[model samples]
Target: MFKSVDLKLQLVELLISSYANVDLSKVKIIGVQHILETTHSMFRSLYLLGLKPENIAIIGKCYSTCKEVFEEMLDDGIYVDPSSSSYCSHKSYDEWFSLNIENFLTSQIDDLLSGKYEKILVLDDGGKCIKALNKFSINTNLIVAIEQTTSGYEDIRYGCFNFPIINVARSATKLNIESPMIAQAASERLYLSLQRKGLKTNKVLIIGKGAIGNAMKNKFASNMEVVCYDRNQKTYDQAKVELSEIINQFPLILGCTGKISIPFDLHSKISPGTVLASVSS
Candidate 1:
């Protein structure tokens, strides 16, 4: 749903085909995502594979703005709603991560402790479920986790793991195929949004020259002037010396850095009427 509809359909077909040979009857499937839309088809695929309704849970860790949309999708019966499935949206990302994730996973673990399922399989986003898993002592039944994002992989990479993890974040399929498509979609959306406002700009400043940033730069460069900066490059050359020196020059500034690319004090450096866009979650 995040990328091309064809790609999403192909992945779902692949997963459903592969699930035919697997025994997931006793494996409790727990899914976590920023939005419920991406995980809806996944839960449905598992159900089509004959996984029980009581054994599947697709929990959405979305924001307040998305709560209504989630409810509407459920109302529309967009996906198979298992008996154990539920979701809650918060006002901020930190609130959901620090408080809600562990609480939700704790309820699932309680079921595990009560001998409901032989094993737990997590579909994680942002590594929140894995981070929450570290708190429990019941490691034997927690078999595997699939992490979806690069930021999530980086967060859990140095941590001690008791079970096998599939790092889909670092997978070549995601890096080579998905990232560019996502970046291109993001770039076009931002450009179109600006166009609707009649705020056309020839120059764009892109922060963080990573895969997404580079792809976005290439996309924008086809029609506009684009300049990129990464923190890693600042130490090597004068051209990247200080973002503050050129912060006010560009009418459009895009942040693709996953971390904070602009400081609080530098907010004053941005010119009046400048448009700031973020491609990060």
Candidate 2:
């Protein structure tokens, strides 16, 4: 029974607390189709913060689901692509439309420089749209970008977008649609299923000391006997485990190392019931 104001406050709290001590006035939100709903929530939150609807703009592909969600909201101040007929139908009012990333970039930049917005908030890496936006001369004083996957991080770094990017790690794209509570319930169900099947603490082995590997290690540590293996000598030393010893000891493995293949004969070392879960990017 979350009220709109409660949801808005939660989003504002997340956005503000995420950057800690940063100004959030006049920010433009950018994302792809999948992030549309989340962006809508953000829009409501920003509006509740006393910002006008005209100050915010969205740049992404127009999809039926997105259209349905946007249409349901009374404040249709979002700027969409003109070629997208679904968005075009509502173009007469507060709607803005563009055909491609190039056009969207041009228009958004103009709006930003025209003393309309002060900050820019990138919700998710909008495919190549982020890269395209990077080529333009943006006028905002501060830029905030969010990343959910390793691929998005690479995109922000390599795209040469001059902005302070924040990586908000999320589950797989499909699982992101479910609320965090629901996803946790689903994970608990899976864990119960495994336990009921007499699975003896699936010896979950993670390979890599990077952020993703560390996250996986933390997640599976409570349910399974977890071991981490990294090629980096220093990291292995820090973890107090040797790769060779791990390779020789366990057959259940998750390869988080960036390497294409495990260094040793992984198949021949483990037992028949050993399970491998790869979390490598």
Candidate 3:
């Protein structure tokens, strides 16, 4: 079902070649949770690259769409499922908890204290691991970090950290090349959802004019009357006004903004049967 399996393999090979001389067993990995099979394959490749099974930790997301498959694929590493208790608890670690907190930090600190790893590598999404680190004092060496989402980068951009973080979220390869495909896939899915409900609309309102929003606007322009509005575009365009004025004008509303594009007060202004979809995290 994953279309990017080949590309994921290429990434694995690139990582393997890049760290060919380094001892992977001495490196501690902290990564984000993802549902795609391609993400699972990437973790599996890392295990095969001689990184200690226990050294690799997969932090759980706020919600899991593929927990069973993830656990089955990466059985050796520390599996931090928010729904369960801590797997590898430490006496010194605090008892903080949340829906996505599965004691990931505790286990990693325990391993570090036991002299299991000399360096830490963070592969994060939405800045989950970075936020977790801010909660406690980590005395280990953090070498390098990679964040692959714009929201995640924004979260850590102003914050102080010991390591150099790479922002793959705003990279040319992701924004210029991959975003349009993502928008296309999202549009196709939205189309299918509308078809299943037998809903038809002549007008669509897009809430953000960023990469995904702009691509989505183009995608729907040929099929329906599309209107795109962004906070940044209000300065020059007359049509780019507050959402409340045009909230009921369109039968379909799509939120391309990663944050809350629509507030609670505006929800009452929307048409009764209008479909709302968000293509962003």
Candidate 4:
């Protein structure tokens, strides 16, 4: 237990050191829900960098589980949308993401009683946080906004907002390691579901030759005969079967491309009991 906490502290140290040369003493940030493991470290690191406890406000209840969301020691100061004992009474996740959270946060931010913040942070994979901040009326000189989700990064990349966005979601290390592993896990979940349905088979069709697609191919190849596809000529040349011909032949089809690269025209050819999984956005 101590070892894990110690590792978290070390990561905090590294994060703090990244800004050691900068004059961040005057920066005031309001962090919303963040990944569970890093939230404590992030909160402590910001305070050590010279921000006051009151200057940092946190939102959201948990990460992957309810236990991770409702915590007694998670906050030292301002807390919004906290997962208290009555958390079950709060709006459902869909309702919160759609309007409740945006309304609540926007109301708090428009009023100075919540403390003026220069930045807002979020990781819920919902656009409401950004939408709320976009409508903020606080007196502080709000500069840039930061995000911690792949879908949020999609919004930034597509020019959804006018402000500068720092997408910590696709940090170089994460794109190279964390994301591929997560994609692999998705593939595993798909395989397990297929197994539960008594649909295990040796032949599989994997689309995309990118990191995630390739990872899925490798992870699935050991148990199944795998055929990979991509729009690129190089990838197509290496695959043993034509994309059009394999759709009807394979019992399982997975699209690993980051976008919708799978052809809808071929959907009609799929076997009746086909199992389809995708990691596309």
Q: Is candidate 1 or candidate 4 better by lDDT?
A: 1
Q: Would you list the C-alpha lDDT of every candidate in the order shown?
A: 0.70, 0.54, 0.70, 0.59
What is the alpha-carbon lDDT for the whole of candidate 3?
A: 0.70
**Candidate 2 per-residue lDDT over residues 195-276, each given as its tens digit:** 6977655566667765556656666778677776666653453666545555655545666553433643545655677655
Q: In model 2, what lDDT does residue 88 have?
A: 55
- Model 3 per-residue lDDT tens digits across residues 220-250: 9999998887855652135646778778888
Q: lDDT tens digits, residues 129-164, model 1?
A: 787777787755456889988767877999997877
Q: What is the Cα-based TM-score of model 2?
A: 0.48
Model 3 lDDT-worst window of ten: 90-99
RMSD of each: 4.6, 10.2, 5.5, 6.5
The superposed Cα distance between candidate 2 and the true structure at residue 204, in angstroms, equals: 3.4
Assess the local accuracy of residue 110 in candidate 4 as a C-alpha lDDT between 0 and 100.
Answer: 42
